[model samples]
Target: MVFFNLWSVLQWYLRPFIKWFLRKTTRLCELQRICYGDKPGAERSRNVEKSLMLSRTRDVKQVVSYLDNTVLERSFVPRNFPEILNPSVAIILRAKKINPKLHELFIVSFRRCLAQIWSYRLLLEEVEEMRKTHYDSSLPEHEEKLLKLWSLLVPNEDLESRVTKQWQYIGFQGDDPKTDFRGMGLLGLENLLFFASEYPQASSHVLSHSHHPKYGYTYAVVGINLTSMAYYLLKDGSAKTYMFNARQYLPNMNLFHKFYCYLFYEFDKMWIESKPENMMEFSIIFKKFENAIRNELADPASVFRINIEVDTI
Candidate 1:
């Protein structure tokens, strides 16, 4: 902790001098040089954010805060992400006096990088709000989404009652799923619903695997477990590598659910292949699975494509 604090203080003092020297020698500002040097992906986005944020310029710092604030309200739309970023990107370019016409490529790359960077912030906000929301039997909206999850996963049959043993068929520990949702909250339900609705065939396949006589595990519980895993990965910013590199996925709740689907599908494959003796092995296997994901997330180039690998579509 002491070392980190000193390092932080050192960077605060030295960064401006380094930026000035780089600007003088390369005839490029920090942003230009970073975008120019790093390929257009996670690494680039990460550095661009760090560069702008570390900048002493007020406008550059404001750019990040503005983007952070943009996602907080209900009015924020994914379609308008780029539209909103245009002026902020302009702010950044103007901060260093870079001409948009002269640096057309830079402008394009910077905007894409910003989209990936800030959309991630939006995801963190959304995840926080969802995780904090407890499953309530009283709220109709919560109950409706919970019922919708059941319908999505078990469409051929109707749930006999709101609180019954049927919940265990989907992997809940008890008849009342409300109790099981204590940990991950609505985020778990949302992730499960996304897998069922968006990738129905794939989700069904994984759900079927949960009932394997020898290797069977609880489907919904595993999903909620994976949601807890996903929440930490996203929360810690470890997911940026996959999130930023997978440019096809707009950073939104769907993108997050898409990530959860990958974990669920992969875990099913792992569990069946490993052939663990019983549920007792679940804790060990789940830990290994999470570590494996963390390892994948370590690579800035790692990308996710659950649709390509598992979706029937």
Candidate 2:
């Protein structure tokens, strides 16, 4: 009777944890299947494959095997934030030419507004903490600081109130990979930042050339390992480093222009650099690259796309 009673107690205590473990395992299996592509026998083999991969108990050798050399190189190279800001600066310059007032708007979006958004995010976190602690002491001080910051950043009281209210829902809680901004594609945070920092007259600047009225261009290049190389190069400074990393891609450069149009166009204004002296050389190189990829690159459907989760508030 005692043994049966102990077994019952153990089951009761472990039921919730067992249920959670099963749910987590199911989700992981689903993700793995998605990554491997839905082949006929893929699902059945995954569990066996997973067990084989994890069964290795070696210490140092296991770590060495998992180390990605390319990632290590990229980590060492420091990227200059200023280079990324160049596009935003160009947008401001173009806007200033059309409407001087809008140049300030771009600055506000890039600088002040972005800063205020972070500040509000921090305030929201503190407010949540205060709620958990059930203390009014932290509330007064936090409210005072938030009010001061809000007034300086947002002059309009109504707008400040509205922004604060909405911020509560959209608050970033933790380093949740699922909440990363990659999943939304065109409507993602990167686009939002570009949208905010870009001037109202961006369309006009992009459409300035009579022959092409498109607002943006995309560049898709192909090479044996251009994707792998470019991914790292983007993290580092000096355009020269990128050129070196992607040297092999140069031969097939033509593939880039053929597949992705953005390479030849300025992202903010979408100006085409097709003139012989300008970016024609780039186009030729990229077209050949595209052709090579089309011939050699296997089924692209099996390619793993980067996954970023969106946090909808």
Candidate 3:
């Protein structure tokens, strides 16, 4: 037992040295490739070297932009890079080795990259999980909760009605509302339920906007679309800036749901304020809104929040 304990202690102490050695060896090999320019993959290695050098000199936005335009667009890092580097500790070690003078910039850039990778992995796993989880109507609890959510959203409507075009008022695809949830599965329902249940006033307010004869859009469809937009932002690494600026750390589902709520409220305002001629313009309008959001996220200090004071509907 004592011998085993001693071995464990030795291993623990040696871990950092081992990691440093590995990184040093990798750096040396990359430098050698860049110097020799003979190997087929040398050019890629040279790019990585250039990236490292640029990371040292560039500001946070520049580094993030470079990464977004280049590294993230391609498959430069493996999916498990975050686990290997562990972002926080990796930043310290990286700063020490790369350029201590630019430690602040290094940490910021490293953290943003780390956040992007981690957030993307989380989003992919979440989306796949949601896709697998079909909404089972047979479960009484699920049915009851879903109906309860409906009641909350449309208090005046009769709950016992089997089918009605009234469902269209809230943006479901058909008389049977379950079909509308087919693409997003239970996740979509849960997000809507959360919005309605947690912020009943806000949810009902948005529903009213959906009823507008001129500029209104489908409530549920728009909600699902916003979910897709949120997922896209998360998956593509754009949300990293927002998440990083908001928390300076990786975000969990709670934060994600809050972001969804913000989108729900904000998109309603955008739709009303822009006053599109018809529903056919939703794609163009949504793209414009997305670009506006991307520009806001480009700022390092930007933080998204749910403003309770914003007038409902």
RMSD of each: 2.3, 25.4, 14.8
Candidate 3: 10-residue stretch with minimal lDDT: 37-46
TM-score of each: 0.91, 0.18, 0.61
lDDT of 1 by residue, 1-313 (tens): 9999999999889988988898999999988987899977889999998877777788888877777777776434667865687788889888899999899999988988887877788789889999999989999999998899888888889999998999898899999999988899888888998888988889989989999999999999899999999999999999888788877765788778888989998999889999999999999999998999999889888887775656653
Task: Select the stronger candidate by lDDT from 1 and 2.
Answer: 1
By summed lDDT, which 10 consecutive residues of candidate 2 come out lowest?
304-313
Per residue, candidate 3 scores C-alpha lDDT tens digits across 1-313 of 9999999899767755764585577753232233233222213222333444434323433434544443334332446445544444344344445553534444444445454444545555665576557777787866776787778898888655746677776788788777877777777777788888877888888888888989888999889888877777776756655554454445556556667788888889899999999999999989988888888766545678877665353
Model 1 lDDT on a 0 to 1 scale:
0.86
Give candidate 2's total backbone clashes: 22
By lDDT, rank the candidates, best first: 1, 3, 2
lDDT string for model 2 (206-247, tens) is 223322333122211111122222222222211111222222
Question: What are the clashing pairs of model 1?
Answer: none
Candidates 1 and 3 compared: the better one by TM-score is 1
TM-score of 3: 0.61
